[model samples]
Structure formats: C-alpha cells, structure tokens
Target: MKNEQIVLAQRPEGLPGDETFRYEDTEIKKPDNDEVLIESVYISVDPYMRGRMNDTKSYSKPFEIDEPLNGHVVGKIVESNHENFSEGDVVTGGLPWKKFNTVSSDAVNKVPSTEVPLHLYLSTLGMPGHTAYGGLLEIGKPEEGETVVVSAASGAVGSVVGQIAKIKGAKVVGIAGGDEKVNYLTETLGFDEGIDYKKDNFSEKLAEAVPDGIDVYFENVGGPISDEVFNHLNTFARVPVCGAISSYNSKEDNGPRVQQKLIKSQALMQGFLVAQFQDNAKNASEQLAKWVQEGKIKSEVTIAEGFDQLPEAFRNLFTGDNFGKQVVKVSNSLD
Candidate 1:
C-alpha cells in the first residue's frame, strides 16, 4: 500500500501558507516487534505547533525541513506486532501526519472505551483539555466569589478553563473576537460575562465585567487584551500563562510594560507547559471526563473534512477561522 504524508517544506518566516507544506507518497511499512501500524483517523492542529515551524528553540524540538510534521493524532491499529494491542485497537499519540504510521507501541496510548465521539480524543478529551485542567487549577487557583477572566474563551483550552472556574464557584468572564463567539461563551458555555475584544471599547467593557477585579487570568491570546486585563488585577491575583496566539506569527511581540501592574497588585504570573504536571495526568483526565459525563463541561470543536485539509486547518488557528478545538477527520471508518 502507498501512504501519503505531509512534510515541512521550509521554516515559515511569517504566517504559514501552502508553500510551507509538501506532500509525498511512500510505501507503507509493516510493524516490527513491539510496534504497530496506525491508520490516521483524526489530527489535531494547535497554536503551539506554529513555534515548532520556526527554527527557534522551544520546549519541543523544531521540525526539520522535509521531515514529516507531527502532532496529536488519533488512529486505528491495522496491524500489530505487540502483545498489548490488537488489529483494530484505537489509539492516540504525537504521530506524524500520514495516512499510515509504523511506530513502537510504547509511543501510543490506547483509547479507553467511552460513549464520547472518537474525534474527542484529539480535542477536549486529549491534549487541549489537559492543558486547561492543569494550567488553571494549578496556577490560577481561583477561589469562590472571585473573578476569573479567560482570553480566547471560546477556544478548546480556554473554554474548559472557563467552565472549570465556574464549577469552582468563581465568576468567569470570557474574552473573544466577535459577537458570535462572545455569545457562545455566555449562553452556551455558561461564562458569567463575555467581552468582544474586537470592539474599540474593549478595555471599558472588560473593566465593567470584572467590577470586583480579576482574581485569576487564564492568559491565552496575549497582546493588548492582556495589557488591559493586567490593569484590572486584584491584589494577590494569579495569572497562568498558557499561550500567546496573537504574537505567534510576529517577528517581535512588543507591548506596554507590565512591571508596574504586577508590583502594584502583588500578583503571581507563571508560565507553564502541561507536560510539567505529568504526574497528575490521570487525575486531571478523570476529573475532566467526569465533568463531561455529568454535563458540567461541554466539548466544542470545528472539524475539517479530510486529511488534505490539514494545512488549511492549521492556518485557521492563527486566523481565528475555527471555533473550539480544531481537528481534521482523516477517515470515517473508525467512527
């Protein structure tokens, strides 16, 4: 069988386009001992992958030019040479964007039997959900009656952060780009308030929403929105720095100094990667899954149709072209 794979053509200088990706056809390799052959089903596209496209140093190694790009992928085992897996087992892992992948079984995790959709393993039930649960609860530490603000509130990570905060009894305010997204935050996700950052009077609206001052800020889209949010921080407030999608494509991200705000509020600001809390992965996943099962948390996703849509789906992360978790459905057979 011939396998189709997507590779990084070149390091991106700015916003990546079709020129950044290349497609190739190759013969599918059978799994060896302790290995499995995975048929790609759902692929996740995230903002952090943008940093990997640049040849810069990051928490994860940069993708080399001409190598097949990889991310969180959900797949089905078509062949297995391992004792732990079978011919039709479902799995997910950081796998290459290919029609078929042959890798050691140790690298992938089997999907638990659940009533939720399989695509969710690449979305809320996967990496993005873990990022939210770990970052917000560990760093943000929101308290009852306190105000919590989440930028990009309708997104995969931010939406979960908002709902979890609400479950903790904190008043949650969500900041998003348009009226439609803002409505999703308040009406659908149960956020206490939603602010449209695209409005010229965003700062004024943000101030009005958090009258008691922000006790926790789940920073996602850092830029002018965060600069304004800082000005509303309560004393001893906590800021969990998760991502900065606004500056992902920029050569340099310049903004107003935040030293004065931090000093005056005596707040704590910390940047974290979900991997840092690996020890708590099981606990976090269990709690998130329970919340989801109880209808306390809802999964929001924008799924693209085919494997060919991967590049466009990835570009959508930067353009805000997608809502919730962005994933591409490579096959329907798994469903």
Candidate 2:
C-alpha cells in the first residue's frame, strides 16, 4: 500500500523554511518475517529537529537531503509476522513521518494500557518526558527548599522539569515567551512563579521571583535567559543544559557569556543529550509514570491535526508559538 512521507528537500542554511521539505507518496511492502507493519497515529515535532536539519556534527546524525524525516511515532500494528507484536496492538517507536511504517518487531514497544491515551506515549511517556526526568535528577540534583528555574518552561521538556522540581520540594520558577504561557506555567503547571521573557522588565522579574537565588537551572532556552539565570545562581548551583531552543533559528552562535559567574560561584554546568542516557530510560520512565499516576506531575500537549501539518507544527517550536509538546495527530481511531 502507498504511504505519505515528508522528505528533507534540502539542508537548511540556518532556520528551515518551506523549501527545506517536500511531501510525497510512496509504497510499502507487507511486513517481512519477524517484522511488523504499523499505521502511525501521532507524530512528535521537537526543537531538536532543527539541529538535525543542518549538515553539522552533533550527538545525533543529521537527516540527509532527500531522506524521509524520522522522529518518535505512536502507531498500531496492522500486520505482524513476529511473536512479540500482534496485529491491533498499539505501539510506540522511532519511525519516519509517514502514514505507515515497516519495522523490525524488536523496534516497537507495546503500549501498556489504553486507559492512558496513546498520544501520551508520544509525549509524557516518550523520549521528551524521559529526557526531563533523567536530565534533571541525574544532572541537576535538585534539593528540597532550593530554588530552581527553567527556560521554555511551557514547552515539553521544560514543563515536565518544573513540575518534577516542585514534586521534589523545590521552589520552581519558569521563564516563557508570552503572558499566556506564563499563566499556564504558574496557574496550570503549579510553578511557584512565572516570568515572561518578552516583557521589558524580564530580568527584574526573574530577580524578584528567585529571591533565594537559583540552586538549579534546568536550561532549555539558552541565550540571554541562561546568562541572566547564571548570574543569579548561588554557590555550588547546578545547571543541567538540556536544549537551546532560543538559538535554534539563529544564523550566528552567540549566547550570553557567563564564564566569570560560573568561576565565582563554583557552579556545576553540564550539557546532556538524552540519547546518551538510553540505558536509564526504563528506570526514569517508571518513576515519571508513577509520578503521573500519583498526581505529583502534570503534562500538557499542543496537538495539530493531520500529517500535512507536520512542517508547520515543527516550525512553531522554534518560533515559541507552541505550549507543551507539539504533536500532530495522523488518524482518528475513535472516529
């Protein structure tokens, strides 16, 4: 049967535009022995995809021009030749942006229960959620009553990081782009304080929010926000650098220089790519899932309909136009 796919039309010069990708139809053969055929239900659009658009060296290889773009997908097995996966079983895995995928049975993990929406597996129970859990606990090591700040606090990873910090008894503050996002962070997400970086008095607001000084900075949006947070960090503060969405669309690689602050405060600043902690995902997922079940954490997702909206949904992440995990629903099983 034929499937629709989005291909990397060209390597983006800086930020990707419409010309960078092309949507086309292709045919896929039935599953081979020990393989499964999947129909995608939802696909994730993430900030890290921007880095993959450039033909530069990174922890993950860049998507080659003319190749189908791949990311986390939640799908249902329509055909299976493997013992592990059965037809009609819902699963989650890495798959290209397409209507269907032919993959090895081992590549798909069965969804635990239908009680939780399948789309949740593509966000809170998926790579982005695990990144927040492991990156914060392992790298940030936040303590009770300590002050913690996170940029892009309304986005996927940042939102989860802040909620988890609060669960751990920290005074959590979030930095976001607009008033709507700031409101969601403070009112919905249970953050102690929310600062709108777009405001003229952002730096002053941040200083007021973090009165005790930041003990942990779970940095997602870098550039000036990170610089200002760095300056406010107390001695021995920990900075878990997860992503830099603020600079994803920039032509130049300029960010706030805070080396002196790091030196003076004796803070620990470390960057981490989630893939590096694949071995710990299982443990982290269990913990995060438990927290969700116990009402200790909450997650939000911004969903767009159809696979055709993939490009626009992805662009929204870099533009700071989306709140929480940006996802595209490919099909309506309930309908």
- Specify the highest-TM-score model's number: 1
TM-score to true structure, per model: 0.99, 0.97
Model 1 clashing residue pairs (backbone): none
What's the true lDDT of residue 255 in model 2? 62
Residue clash pairs of candidate 2:
none
Clash count list over all predictions: 0, 0
Candidate 2 residues 23-51, lDDT tens each?
99999868899999999988998888889
Error of 1 at 97 (Å): 0.7
Please write out the lDDT profile of model 1 over residues 79-135, one tens digit for every residue: 999999998899999999998999999989998754788877876789989999999
lDDT for each of the candidates? 0.92, 0.87
lDDT of 1 at 35: 90
Q: TM-score of the candidate numbered 2?
A: 0.97
> Which residue runs does candidate 2 get wrong by more than 4 Å?
none
